[model samples]
Target: MSDQIKFIVDSLNKEPFKKNYNLITFDSLGPMQLLQVLNDVLAEIDPKQDVDIREEMPEQTAKRMLNLLGILKYKPPGNATDMSTFRQGLVIGSKPVIYPVLHWLLQKSNELKKRAYLARFLIKLEVPSEFLQDETVADTNKQDISAMEEEKDQLMKRVERLKKRVETVQNHQRMLKIARQLRVEKEREEFLAQQKQEQKNQVSTESLYSGSQK
Candidate 1:
């Protein structure tokens, strides 16, 4: 026998609850408390076990705990109940290895069942914590919604500013183009006027000379 298994057996022998009941009695126990005890026992049991508990029939551990507590007596505990619906004369391994892990699992299941029962009772009373939780969740959701709206507003403002800036740049460019065109037109007009005045002076000089010749 490994020291770990011996440790579990010894611990349970001394536990206040187990001592209260000669055999295992779970009827008056709270679920959460029972689970804690089960976990404690399992902690002691795992190091001594030879098998990988995760690969084994996990449910059997639960069954064993309940059976040990005298809560589930209708069927025999452990893999025996799991493997055979009706006993066949043929047995696979004449002896099955009972590990501390299996027993620990059983203990945990019993504890969980008790806790579930307590939870149900608390729910029936409509405890304050339940309502408080709903309010907290609602407040959290509201904050998230408000934050999103604020971000959206900021993005919209930024877009509006960018649009205004683009419009101003476009307007300035249009004005500059128009000013250049007007300047070019004024220069062309001045050049044409100068040419016209020069032609008039030459014609006037030619007419005067012709008259003199006559």
Candidate 2:
């Protein structure tokens, strides 16, 4: 592992919460106290970004810390450099907490000129690879679930549109049927009136012929 990573692990291990109690049982402090500690660590990384660390639960705070560390590992603030140059960069501008922590470790390493301390610090941190893998899997699953939900919503909208089209077609068919029935009724009434007029004209002609004969 790189010196920066080693330092981050070391600093995390040295945290008061981790030093005083088991990290697995993460309830050594109250909410506000826990928030303060988290912010203090984050301040070493990016002081301006430390707005609020208060969470409804301790697990949330722990998760946030883990995520921050992951980001530092994947996307460091600046280009990789030797321990000396890296230290200078921190003095110039704010960097992740790992930069300062590693600077301290590098100084100690130069003074002692021994690898034993570094080895012990690594052993003390002992972060599990499976934990990082699990985080990755969880994120992937969440994305997949979100995608499936979006697809489902799209299909529902399509079904609604089809339903509206079917209703429109049915309404149009009913209107056409009503119009055909009205046309047939009007033609039948006209035919009956014509027949009655013809019968009246025939009777009037017969009466006029009988009066002329008389």
Candidate 3:
């Protein structure tokens, strides 16, 4: 990670939260130190997301840390380095791979915390009139709502079109099923008619033979 980002994260931890971190050796941290930092950062973001690395192995701690980060919707920075980079970077001390993730985590910690708070706040509390009282905020919200309505309409139309196609397919299948039933019924009727004709022919042949014999 760049010095600028490290400073930002360090400053953020220092100021309002008064959280202590080994930012100077952030890039060269061992797996255990890294795990402590991770747990602290996650706790700062959300207390419910705290991880215990005390009894677990290094690999378990690394994997569990990655899982927690994943729950917060954090994707690894580079296209080359995927989520699996945790063990190599955190455990094996790969600077290029690990620092970026830590940098991202540090930078996003406050933002995520605020978002979590807002989500809970909105669930229980209605939108405060003070925020809506601002013309800019109200207008922006109105524009957003209008756009969302348009998107919803488009999605509903697509769903209706799909339903129509499905109905057409169902109708075709129904017709084919009826056709098969009719074919089987017609075959059975033809077989019964043929059997009756053969019985009459045998009876006529017997009568003719009896007359000739007499």
Q: Which candidate leads in TM-score?
A: 3
Of the two candidates 1 and 3, the one with more favorable TM-score, higher being better, is 3
lDDT of 1 at 132: 21
Q: lDDT score, residue 155, model 3? A: 82
Q: Estimate each model's TM-score.
A: 0.22, 0.24, 0.43
Off by over 4 Å in 3: 2-5, 12-28, 114-214
- Put down candidate 3 lDDT per residue, 1-214, tens digits, no spaces: 4685566457546755465555565545575655576666667777754666677676655555554454455555654334344444655546565556566767777787876455432322233343344344345445545666677679899999987886778577788789999999999999999999999999999999999999
Q: Any residue pairs clashing in model 2, and if so which? A: none
Provide the global lDDT of candidate 3 against the true structure. 0.60
- Evaluated at residue 172, the lDDT of candidate 1 is 78
- In model 1, the worst 10-residue window by lDDT is 86-95
Considering only N, C-alpha and C atoms within 3 Å, which residue pairs clash in candidate 3? none
Candidate 3 at 146: error in angstroms?
A: 34
lDDT, residue 19, candidate 2: 39
Query: Among all windows of ten consecutive residues in candidate 3, which has the lowest summed lDDT?
Result: 121-130
TM-score of 3: 0.43
What's the C-alpha lDDT at position 49 in model 2?
30
Q: Candidate 1's residue-wise lDDT over 1-214, tens digit each?
A: 3444444445466643253422224223443334445534443433222233334443443333332222212232344444232111011111122333334444564564554344322312222222223333234334545666677679899999987886778577788789999999999999999999999999999999999999
- Judging by lDDT against the true structure, name the best candidate: 3
